[model samples]
Target: MADLETLKARKGAVRRSEIPSNVLTALNRGEIETVNLVEFLAVDHAKLFRSTRSQLSLDDKSAKLIAATIKKLADVGVMQRLADTGQVFHQVLDGSEDREAVYQQLAAHPSDVLRNWAAYMDAANAKLTFAQRLKRAKPFAIDDNMGVREIAWMCVRVPAADKIVSQIEKLHPFAKHKNYLMRRFAIELSRPCGVWTKHITALKERPEIAQPLLEFCREDETKYVQDSVANWLNDASKTRPDFVETLCDRWLSETNSKHTQRIAHRALRTLRKKADA
Candidate 1:
């Protein structure tokens, strides 16, 4: 298990001023952890990054190396920028001679953001094949930190987008994975409208293009994987309501379990809401 700091110490603060200076110092040193979504959003990533480079002993020119990403991080909203920074950190550190050592350090760090960068670095290794990239992300997909788990999927999302047809069959086996995290990763990678990441439009307009992947998880045992499958179908529902409705109907008839029932209910929520409206 990760040696997490006391979240209570970092709790109940929105702005930098609202937090104690010592707490901010601890945050910079990757000592304290963000306790919730609000604290995660409130973090000053650029400042945290400065400490990161310093601690890593990166070249002084590292700022220039990542300048373009720094600009995007500032211009974009909080969540988008956080995910973007993961990519930036990966790109900058990918070629170092000590990259493996550096990534190991980041992967084991107390700060969820730095650990997320470690996952991004592995996932963004252009040398890895699509299936290999999925394998590389296994650790972060199941990371104890909620933030690390969320960013794990976003890290590999775009590259996997183009290979949906060619590699999805290979990915199908993961739907039945003993580790629910890997199962969720398989579904999230193909989500049509995954937040703060590129969409798989093909999956949206033509839900059946990846039906084999979704079909395997229709009665997934874990609520974590079930929610991912349901959310993927819900995303498709906006564009292919007929397809979603028909598939949910079939699933209802074929499967009898609280799992499938819950999935179908949540899967049709958007369509159901529209009809009621």
Candidate 2:
């Protein structure tokens, strides 16, 4: 493993050339996570990816094809490309003789990027129903790596929103998950307006579409999860202030817990801002 202290002490590498060779090597070797967005953006993932294929000994014809595809995407942005890579890999795995063995390794890979691909593979599987896809993403949703946890929901959110009426209800377990990240993932999966992702248009208009999961999470004491629920309402408030104001009022009346109060307070920020303005 690379020296943790060395990585953390980094002044912050915004360009590939600025990265210390050892730290860059460690990152390419998938021995460490990127310290920040700059480091992440500076990484040229093609070499790291090829090394991973070699380490895994995926020498089949399918592997060769994927290798070529990955090479082409070396300079591409990670956000959309990673999801596509995951889907392509899944198609290859689904037809491979060693599907289970290969997939298990990928899902448990040391590289957060590869694990993210694994999350997207499940996300891109059209065969699975929306409910099943959410269930399948649980491990990644709760991944120790923040990057993997984010992708776990980002990749699945579209499918979930397409069937929001049914999908939100099926998320009972995730909304009430033991892990805060997983619970946050459940709410983020339904955010009417998410960061860097398309809005769930229906949710922007019909706040009720997300009520089930929001209700389950409203009392969450975890600030991380609470923030997501609050943000969900905040997003809705942009389009439906009355609904958000009404809900916030009701929540304040129904629960005196500070946690609930915190959520209610945060949820009404937009309205409060408007009133003050």
Candidate 3:
């Protein structure tokens, strides 16, 4: 084992010029404490440090150790303590099996910490290519756990809108997906008035971005699907009040699905209330 002081100095020196091999060697030699190293990485160069792990060519032994080290951090509530949500999120995501368990825990956690952490993770998707991020996020969209699915939708939302230039057209397939959750994912995430997201000014201007999923979800039986459709229309009602009223009126006239009518009524709640007043 190398001197602890020397290891600490080396860990502190991790920068753009830092070599992953040197860090791996230190960890392999048991010179640096895994807990200490992870803490340092989390506090300092979190995103860069996560990238460095891949560059290190993590073998089975090293990967096991790294994953365990990350779990240890979770065990100690290190993620909750961290000021940087991105650092906390990526560190959790870096784990192997423990990653899923932790995500479940975070999803059920109180809204403040977990929700913010999820938002940060979504923002971090900018680092991945459009296809790469979407591929990784697809599974989560339909995950049984509601919290995990919300995070998945969050991940899909920004990259689709911000990273990919053809946001609306590209998202059309999600509307037609066999899974209702996925169809809901498309509607909820891409809403013009999405909360805790960058409002798509384009939706207010074009409004057509929502067309692909709107009518499809209206015909669906799932309450979850109906809610997303209704919520999206409700959001639009805030900005495009007339458009929502007209659309809902048309849907109510055309569709006998009580579910669809229920959604349309809820979506026009504000307008109806105003008209009555």
Best by lDDT: 2
lDDT of every model, 2 decimals:
0.75, 0.78, 0.60
RMSD over all Cα atoms, model 2: 2.4
lDDT of 1 by residue, 237-264 (tens): 9999999899999989987988999999
Question: What would the per-residue lDDT of candidate 3 be over residues 1-277, giving only the tens digit for each residue?
Answer: 3555655565344453454555545444333423233333333223323433443333556445544544445534433333244444555456555554444443343222243344445446445566666655675677554545665766666556764335565566778889888798888777887765677777765566577679768888889888888888888887888788888888889979899888997888887887899
lDDT of 2: 0.78
lDDT of 2 by residue, 6-107 (tens): 575566676767888887776777766676666676555677776677656365777887777777887677786787788778887776677656666778
Score candidate 1 by lDDT.
0.75
Error of 1 at 117 (Å): 1.9
Candidate 1 is scored at a TM of 0.82
What residue runs in model 3 are displaced by over 4 Å at the alpha carbon? Answer: 1-127, 163-165
Candidate 1 least-lDDT 10 residues: 1-10
Candidate 1 regions exceeding 4 Å error are 1-5, 8-23, 50-76, 79-94
Q: Provide TM-scores for the models.
A: 0.82, 0.90, 0.59
After superposing candidate 2 on the true structure, give the runs of residues whose Cα lies further than 4 Å from its correct spot.
Answer: 1-18
